[model samples]
Target: MSNLIYNEMIKMIRKKRLLVITLILIVLIPIFTYAQYKMLQNTIKNVGSSNWRTILQQQIVDQQNRLASSRVPEEYKHLIKLNIQQRQYYLDHNINPNAPGAPTFVRGFVEQGISLFLPLLVIILAADIVSSEHSLGTIKLLLTRPVPRWKILLSKYIALLLNISFVMILTILLCYLISGIIFGYKGWTFPVISGFQSKGEELITDYVHVLPQWKYILMAYGLAWFICIVIGTLSFMVSVLMKNTASSMGVMLAALISGNLLEQVAHSWPALKYSAFTHLRLTDYLAGNTSLIPGMSLPFSLTVLSAWAIVSLVIAFATFTRQDVLT
Candidate 1:
């Protein structure tokens, strides 16, 4: 089992999906960090040194003015409200929302990256894990070996978990390196106010206390890791069920894109809430949007995602072990 797992890991390395993901991150992070750096420089130039308080106050006023506008849309009004709430938190706590530091850029970038790019990459890798073997006529070679089919499938699943973990860790490392170089790595100890979950016009009265930057990043990424695992497992099941790697990828990718469509069109539909795709962006929970629609919470999201992962694992094992290798 150990040797089989090692071989599976080596095969993944040879596939070069990790190389592709790493390259994408390498190219993106510097460009993203540079843009943030330029934005910060412009902010400093506009406000002069030590003027975050002025910027914060100005933003609060701007949100208030937007709220007072008769033409502003309902969605924008909610966003404006959240913006004002965040800025007010900064003002009340004597913290600067635009503080010149690594923590701010890391937090913002990770939130967006985990919401989309990271999961997409993980899905791509998972989509090919099993299907590629069948496509290349390599499943027969494995079936001829002494190992049981279930164990062989288990090895690939373990490798997928390791790959996803590596991706998640690499993402954090790249974010720190790029943002630290651009924005000096200060303020990890700075407090960030969060846990202001909103529903339409009103924020829930219960809120999390202000936490230091490091703690929030850790928790945020931890939740992101969970989302990735759930996504990867489902894609791996597709990989096991399909005969062609491209078909597997297409199935999972279409499902992901379609999940967003359903979210927009049928969020309140019965038990659509129970689908894992509905909760793929669990990091949104960290941003106080516990749902794209109401009636979803972090705990419910976790439970639904876990159930999906478990069911996918069962399907993968059952399908791989029973399916005929010979045509």
Candidate 2:
């Protein structure tokens, strides 16, 4: 089993596509960080640096004004207006609009990278993990190597997990290196205050006390990676069911894109709240907005996601064990 796992890891490491994708992520992180830094610098230059909080407050006000002027439907207009008023109230009291103890630029860049890019990376790597073996006529060869069927699948899954973890660490290191060069690693210990409304309209202000920004980045990264693992497992299940890599990748990507679209439309159709994709976006919970629909709660999202992961794993194992290999 150990040898099988090691071989699978080696195969993944040798894949040119995986290497290229990692390189792309490392390069893109710096480019995005620089662009964001430049934008922030320009804003500071325009608004003056004496009152950074005031500048942030003004920006929130401008956003509110713009949203008010937009041609949104009457139903959502009130929600938008309420959010704008909440922002104004927070700003007026010198409260940081963002959550307290937020990480510095380096840490934030890492977290954003994990949220935005890591899922795609996991999909790219694992989408073909099972399907490609059949596509390349290697599944038969692998099966003949004296390994148990479950062991083989488990090896592939473990290898993929290790590779994903490595990629996440590399992304964080790259973000630190790039952003540290510009931001000089200052403000990492700053407190961040975040507000969330609990059930019964109870406002809860979480004073995330000061910590090294990198520590918070690590926490966010771990959560992000866990979500990606869920995505990867689902894609792996699809790969086991599909005969071709393209079909597997397409199915997963389509599901992701479709879920986001459905989330927008699901606002009207309350029935769409039970979707697996709807729960997959855990970030929505942290963002303090109702996801999938207005009544969908964070605990509900977590339950849905956990159920989906368990079901997908069961399906993958059952299908792989029962299916005929000679096709």
Candidate 3:
């Protein structure tokens, strides 16, 4: 199985998938850095005072005004309340509400970036894992070996997982390195407030815990990586069913982007709580905000994503073991 995984990795390398991922980072990391640069510049130029308490107080006022407006939706109010609570948490603890550095900026980016661009990279690697082999007749040659069909697919799955892990690690490293050049390398040791729980539209302030910033990043990235793996497996299942790369990628692409689309199209559907997409933004839970769909919790989202992943893997393996290669 290890050998099979190695061979699969070799194929991926030969296809220049690694290069593709690196090139994407080359573009994306700079964009993230630039965004942080602009944000810091604006904060410094506009805030008039450099004190954390004053800035946080200003933010509280802004949120209050929004809450006062009759136009704010209940769900958005919940998010605004979360933000206000977090800022207050910092102020009450005598901790500065603002910590702009490599770690903090990267954590902020990961929370938003995982839901958007990370899926595309995962899909590009996984969507072709099976179908491309079939299109090239390599799958037939592999199946002719004495090895079980399931083993071959399992090897591909492991290879895909390793690739996903690599992407996540590299993204964290690059985001920190590039941003550190401008934002300074401090704050990796800074304490952060996390472990927040929600009570309907309000954050349950007492239960939230404080951890080192590095630990929080690891926990946040771990959750995000689980979501990506779930997405990768689902795309792999689609790849197994489709014989062409285009069909496989198209199916996964639709699934990936539909996660965001679900917010607009399916938020009203109560049944959406069961959907994996509803849980994909588990970062919201960790970020001290309400789930994209109300009533969705982190544990619930994890279960939904795990169930979808298991069901997809079963379908893919079952279907592949019985599928005829001589079509």
Q: Pick the candidate with the highest TM-score.
A: 3
Query: What do the candidate models score in CA lDDT, each in turn?
Result: 0.81, 0.69, 0.83
What is candidate 2's lDDT per residue for 1-327, written digit by digit as tens?
789889998888777656877688677866876787777778878877736677767776776776767577755655555455556656656655442221365445544544336777788988998999999998889888776788888898888888878877776666666666766655555543333443333334453233344555566676677778888888889999999999999998888778766877877888777886665555434434333267777678667777787898889988987879995
> Measured by TM-score, how close is model 1 to the native structure?
0.89
- lDDT by residue (tens digit), candidate 1, 151-233: 99999999999999999888888888778887888878878767776666666537757788889888888888888999999
Model 3 regions more than 4 Å off: 264-267
- Preferred candidate (lDDT higher): 1 or 3: 3
Worst 10 residues of 1 by lDDT: 286-295
Which run of 10 residues does model 2 get worst, by summed lDDT? 200-209
Stretches of candidate 1 above 4 Å error?
41-50, 197-207, 261-272, 290-292
Model 3 agreement with the true structure over 1-327: per-residue lDDT tens digits: 899999889888898887899888878888878887887677666777767777778778888899999999876777787778777777888776348789987788778877767888889889999999888888878899899989999998999999999989988988888888888889987888776777765667777777888998998899889988999999999999999999999988887778667755555787877777767776777767655466676677788899999999999999999998885
lDDT of 1: 0.81
Could you tell which candidate, 1 or 2, scores higher by lDDT?
A: 1
**TM-score per candidate:** 0.89, 0.83, 0.94
